[model samples]
Target: MKYDPIDSQLFIKNRKNFAKYMQPSSLAIFNSNDIYPTGADSTLPFAQHRDIFYLSGVDQEESVLVIFPDCPKEKHREVLFLKETNEHIAVWEGEKLTKEKAFETSGIKTVYWLKDMEKVLFELMTQCDTVYLNTNEHYRASVETETREARFAKKLKDKYPAHSVAKSNPILQRLRSVKDPIELEIMQQACDITEKAFRRILQFTKPGVWEYNLEAEFMHEFLNNRSKGFAYTPIIASGNNANVLHYIENNQQCKAGDLILIDAGAEYANYSSDMSRTIPVSGKFTDRQKEVYNAVNRVKNEATKMLIPGAYWEQYHVEVGKLMTSELLGLGLLDKADVQNENPDWPAYKKYFMHGTSHHIGLDTHDYGLLHEPMQANQVFTVEPGIYIPDEGFGIRLEDDVVIQESGEPFNLMRNIPIETEEIEEIMN
Candidate 1:
C-alpha cells in the first residue's frame, strides 16, 4: 500500500472487542473486498472493505480473517488466510505479504494460504456450534451485486447446515462507529492533508479556471502528503451547479464573481476526513455573496456545537433547523410570516438549506454509526450547512469534521482550515 503502516495494536484491540460481543462457540468471519471490474481487461482501483480492514490490517484483496475465540486449539483462535505469493506471481504483480509480514501487519500469529481455507474451515465447523457471518447491514447500503463475503457466507452455511448462524453486522456497526484513539489520530492526519490541499487551492483558484483543474490541484497535494486521493468522488461545483448537492461534473469554468463549492477530503491509511468550503472565484466575494456565505458559516458553527454526547441524530437536526432558521431570518431569506406558518415536517429554514447538516465521518465519507442511538464522545461527524438558491446564481456551504467531546462542545478537526469570511478573504488576497 502507498500509505504508511498503522500500528497493529489497533487491530488487535478491535478483534478482541468484537470477540467479546460474539456468542460463545461462534466463529466470526470477514473477507476482503473484490477488485471491482470496470471494462474489458480493465478494473477500477482496489479498495479494501472497511469491516475486514478494521478487524485485520491486511489491506489486500483475496484475503480472509477468522476469529474462533473459543476454538479447541489456542493457535486457531485467530487466523489469517492470505493469497500465497510465488516466484512467477511475484515477478508479475510484485511481492505480496509474506507470512512474517502478515504477522506484523496483523497481530495474528497463525497464518495460512488461501488454498487451505476449505480444509481448515471444515475442521473449525466440527469444533464450533455457532458461526458469525459478516454482512453489509450499513444503513445507507444498497448492495445488489454479490460480494466475495456474501458468497463465502453461502458456502459456509451450505457446508455446515447444523450450526446456528448469527450476524456480525450489529457488533461491527457499533464498534466501527466509535473511533479509537489511534483511528482519530489518523483521521486528524487526513484532515491536515485536506487542509493543505484547500489552502493550495485558495491561492490557485481564480476566474476562468476549469473545475477539473482545481480537482487536479487537490489530488496533487493529497498524493504528495501520503493520501490516496479523495475520500469520495469530489464535487467541484461552480455557479448554479452548486445548487446540486451531489454535482461532480466539474466540467464548468469558474466565472468571475461566482462561488465554487468544493466538497472534498483526503483518505489517509483508510481513514477519511470530509470537508466542504465555498470560495469566491475572483478572490473576493461581492457584498451579497459575503452575506449568504456568512449565513452558512454561522449555521455550521452553531450546528457543530450541538454534536455533543447524548444528542440523538434526529433531534440534533431539529436543533440545527432552529439555528438555520435564525440565521436565515438575519439574512432576510425568511420573514416572520414564513416562520409562524412553516410546516414542522419541512421547516422554513429548509427552503434555503435543504440537505442534512451533519453525518458520521470516518472510514467512509458518510461513515457508520447507530443513528437511533445517542451520540457519544470520540464519534466524528461532518457539520456542513449550506444555502442554495439557483435563481440567486450561487450557493454557499461551510463544513468541518468534528469530534464529540465528553464534557463540553465538539472539537473541530479542521479548525486550522480557514473558514471565517475575513480569513478566507485575506488568504485569497
Candidate 2:
C-alpha cells in the first residue's frame, strides 16, 4: 500500500456500528478479494474487498474477519485470520502482517493464522445461531464472476445447513454510504490528488497531444501523491469520442479546436474520488464550446444543491432532468415542441445528457447507497452533468464529489480544482 497507515479507530467505529444492526447470536464474516490472474505467471494487482477493509482495515489478500459481539469468549468477539507470515515468506514476497502487526492494523486482539481457521470457525459456528455473509448487492452491480465472498458463502451454507443465514450487504450499504470524519478526510486527500493531476493536465494539454499522453500525466501525478491511481477505468475522450459515454480508448491525437472530456480520479487508501472535467485542446474554448460548457456547469451546480438531507434519490434526478431540459432548450438542442411532444419515459434532455446526474461516491467509485432511502448528512455523492453533441463535434461534462450537509448546500470536495471556463483557460494558457 502506497498510502500511510490509517488510524485504527475508524475501523473500530465501523465495526461497532455494523454490530448494532446484526441479529443477536449472529456472527458476520468478511473475506478479502481474490487476486485475479491475467495469464500464466502473471496476475493483476491485488484489490482488497471494500467491505472487509471498511470494517477491519486489512488491506491484503487471503484474509478473513469475523465479528461476533455476543460471543461467550470475550477474545472471539472481533477476530482476524491472516495468512501466516514466516521468514521464508518474507524473503520471497514482501512481509505479510504478523499477528502483532495485524492487531495494530485492525485493533482486534484475537488473531489467528489461516492454518487454524477451520478449527476456530467450527468452534464459532457451534456458539452462534446465525451467520452473516457478505455479498455484493450494489444497485449497479452486474457481476458475472463468482467472487471469493460468494464462494465462501456457498461452502458455509452447504456445511452449516441448519444455521440461519443473513445478508450483510443491506447493513453495509447504509453504513458505508454515510461518511465518518476519518473517511471524509481520506476522501479529501484522494480528491486533492486528483486536483493535482487535473491541474497538471491543464498546462500540458495542447493541439496534437495524444489522449493517452494526458492519461499518463494523470497517473504520474497520482503516484507521486501516494495514490494507487485511477479509482475506475479513466475516460480521456477527445472530440467525438466523448459522445460514446464510456470511451476509454485514449489513442487519438487532440485536434486544435476539439474539446477533451477527462472523467478520471485518484484512489487513496482504498477511498475513491470521482471527477470529470472538459477542457479545450488548444487551451481556449470556442464561443459555442464555452456556451455548452457553462450550461453543463450550471446544471452540475444546481443538482449539487439538491443533495441535502431528506432528498429522495429518484426525485433528485427528475429535478436534475428538468434543469438539464431547460439548459438544452436554451442551447437550441431542445425546443418547446421537443419537450412537449417528448416521451415522459425518455425526456428530451436524454438526447444530450443521458446519464444520471449523481451517484454515491466512496470506497468504490459507484459506492453503496440504497437509492430508495432519503439522503442523509455526511453522505458523499458526485454531481456530474454532461452535454454530448456529436453534431457540434464535442461533448462537455463537469463533475465534483460533495458531502451532503445538515443544512443548505452540499460541500464540494473538489472546490480547489478550477472548473470555470476563464479559470481553466487562464491556467492552460
Candidate 3:
C-alpha cells in the first residue's frame, strides 16, 4: 500500500460494535472485492471491499472475515482467512499477507489459508443458527457485477437453507456513517493532500491550457503525496461544459474570461476527501463571473452550517434551497414571479443549482449513511453548491468537506484551501 499503516484499533472497535448488534447465535461474514478482469491476461486494479476492510484491516484480495462472537471456543470468535503466500508466489506477485502479518493487520489471532474456508465454515455453520450477510444496500447503489461477497452469500444460503439470513447493510450504514477518531485522522490527511493539489492548480491554470493539463497536475501532486488518485471520476469542466453536472470529458482548451469548475478529490489510506472549486482561466474573473462565484460560495458556507447532529438530510436540503434561493434572487437569476409560482417539488433555485448541496464522504466519495436518519456527530460531509448558467457560457461551484460537531457549527476540513474570490485571485496572480 502507498499509504502509511493504520492502527488496528479502529478495525477492532468496528468489529466490536458490529458484533453488539448481531443476534446471540448469528455469525457475520465479509469478503474482499474481486479483481475485475479487463482482457484475457489483464485485470484492473484490486480494490478491497469497504465493508471487509472496515471489519478487518486486511486490504488484499481473496481475503475473508468471520465474526462469530458467540462461538464455543474463544479463538474462533474472530477469524481471518487470507490467500496463502509461498516462496514462488512471493517472487512472482510479491508477498501476500502471511498468518503473522494478517494478525498484525487485524486483531484476530486465528488466521487460516483461504483453501481451508469450506472446512472451517462448515463447522461454524452447524454451530450458528443465523447468518449476517453483507449486501450492497446503499441508497445510490446500482451494482451490476456479481461481487465476491454476493457469490459467497448465494452459495451459503443454498448449502444451509434453514439458516436465518439477516442483512449487514443496516448495521454498517449507521456504524460507518459516524467517523471514528482514527478515520477522522485519515480523512484529514486526504483533505490536506487535496489542498496541495488545489494550490498547485491555482498557479498552473492559464488561458490556452487544455482541461486535461489541470487533471494531470492534480494526479502528479496526489501520487507524490501517497494518494492513489482521485476518489471519484474527476470533473474538469471549463466554460459551458461546467453546466453539465457530470462533465468529465476534459478535452477542450481553456479560454480567457471562461470559468472552470473542478469537482475532484484525493484518497489517502482508502479515506476520501471531496472538493469543488471554480476559477477563472485567465487568473481573473469577470464582473459577472465574480458575482455568481460569490453567490455560490455564500450558499456553500451557509449549507455547511446546517450539517449538525439531529439534522435530517431531507430537511437540510430544504433549508439550503432557501439559502440558495435568496442568493439567486440577489443575482437576478430568479424573479419574484418565478418564486411565487415555483413548484415545491422543483424549486426555482434548482434552475441555477440543480445538483445536491452535500453528501456523506469517507471511505467512498459518496459514503454510506442513512439519509432518512438524523445526522450524528463525527460524520463527514461535502458541502458543495453551484450556479450553472449555460446561456452566459459559464458556471461557478464552491465546495468543502466538513465534519459535524457535537456543538456549535460543523468543522470545515478544507478550510486551509482558498475559496474566497479575493483569496483565489491573490493565489492565482
Candidate 4:
C-alpha cells in the first residue's frame, strides 16, 4: 500500500456502530475481495472490499472479519482471519500480515491464520443464533462475477442451515453514506492529491499532446503524493470524444482549439475524491467555449446548494434539470419550443446534460447510498454538470466534492483547487 497507516480509531468506532445494529445473538462476517485474473499467473491488482475496510482498516487479500457482540467470550467477539506468513512464503510473495500486526491495524485483538477459520467459525456459530451477510446492494452495482464474500455466504448458509440470515447492506448503506470527521480527512487527502494532478496538467496540456500523456501527468502527481492512482478509470477525453460520456480511449491528440474534459480523482487510504474539469488545450477558452464553460459552472454551483438534509435524489434532478434547461436556452442550444414540446419522461435539458447532477462520493468513487432516501448531514457528494455539443466542437463540465451541513451551506472540499477561469489562466501563464 502506498498510503500511510490510518488511525485505527475510525475502524474501531465503525465496528461499534455496526455491532449496535446487529440482531440479538447475531454474528456478522466480511471477506476481502479476490485478486482477479487477467491471464495465466498475471492478475489484476487486489482491491479490498469496502465493507471490511470500513470496519477493520484491513487492506489486503485473503482476509476475514467476524463481529459477534453477543458472544460469551470477549476476545472471540471481534476476530480477524489472515493468511499465515512464514519464512518461505515471505521470500516468494512478500510478508503477509502477522497476527500481531493485524491486531494493530484493525484494533481487534483476536487474530488467526486462515487455516484455523473453520474451527474458530464453528465456535462462533455455536454462540450466535443469527448471521449477518454482505452483498453488493449499491444502487448502481451490477456485479456479475461471484465475489469471495458471495462464495462464503453460500458456504455458510449450506453449512449452518438453521441459522437466521440477515442483510448487512441496510445498516452499512446508512452508516457508510454519512462521513465521519476522520473519514472526511482521508477524503480531503485524496482531493489534495487530485488538485496537484490537475494543476500539473494545466501547464502541460497543449496542442498535439496525446490524451494519454495527460493521464500520465495525473498518475505521476498521485504516486508522488502517496496515492495508488486514480480512484476509478481516468477519462481524458478531447474534442468530440468528450461528448461520448465515459470515453476512456485516451489515444487522440488534443487539437489547438479543442476542449478536454478530464474526469479523474486520486485514491488515498482507500477513500476517494471525484472531480471533473473541462479546460482548453491551448490554455485559453474561445468565446463560445468560455460561454458554455461558465454556463456549466453556473449549473454546478446552483445544483450543489440544493444538497440539503431533506433533498431527495429524484427531486434533486428535477430541480437541476430546470437549471440546465435555462442554461441550454440561454446558449441557444434549446429553443423555448423544445422545452414546451419535451417529453416529461426525457426532458429537453437531458439532450445536453443527461446524467444525474450529484452522487455520494467516498470509499468508492460512486459510493453506496440509497437514492430513495432523503439526504443527511456529513454526507459527501460530487456536483457535476456538463454540456456536451459535438457540433460546437467543445463540451464543458465542472465538478466539486462538498459535505452537506446541518444548518447553512455545504462545505466545498475542492475550494482550494483552482477553478475560476482567471485563477486557472494565471496558473498556466
Highest lDDT among the candidates is held by which one? 2
TM-score of every candidate relative to the true structure: 0.98, 0.99, 0.99, 0.98
Report the number of clashing residue pairs per model. 0, 0, 0, 0
Give Cα distance to truth, residue 207, candidate 1, Å. Answer: 0.8
230-290: candidate 4 lDDT, tens digit per residue: 9999889999999988998899999988889999999999989898998888888888988
User: What's the lDDT for residue 152 in model 2?
Assistant: 98
lDDT of 2 by residue, 354-424 (tens): 89989999999999999999999999999999999999889899999999999999899999999999999
Candidate 3, residues 188-269: lDDT per residue as tens digits? 9999999999999999999999999999999999999999999888999999999998999999999998999999999998
Q: lDDT (CA) for every model shown?
A: 0.92, 0.95, 0.92, 0.92
Ranking by lDDT: 2, 3, 4, 1
Alpha-carbon error at 238 in model 1, in Å? Answer: 0.7
Weakest 10 consecutive residues of candidate 3 by summed lDDT: 296-305
Model 4 scores what on Cα lDDT?
Answer: 0.92
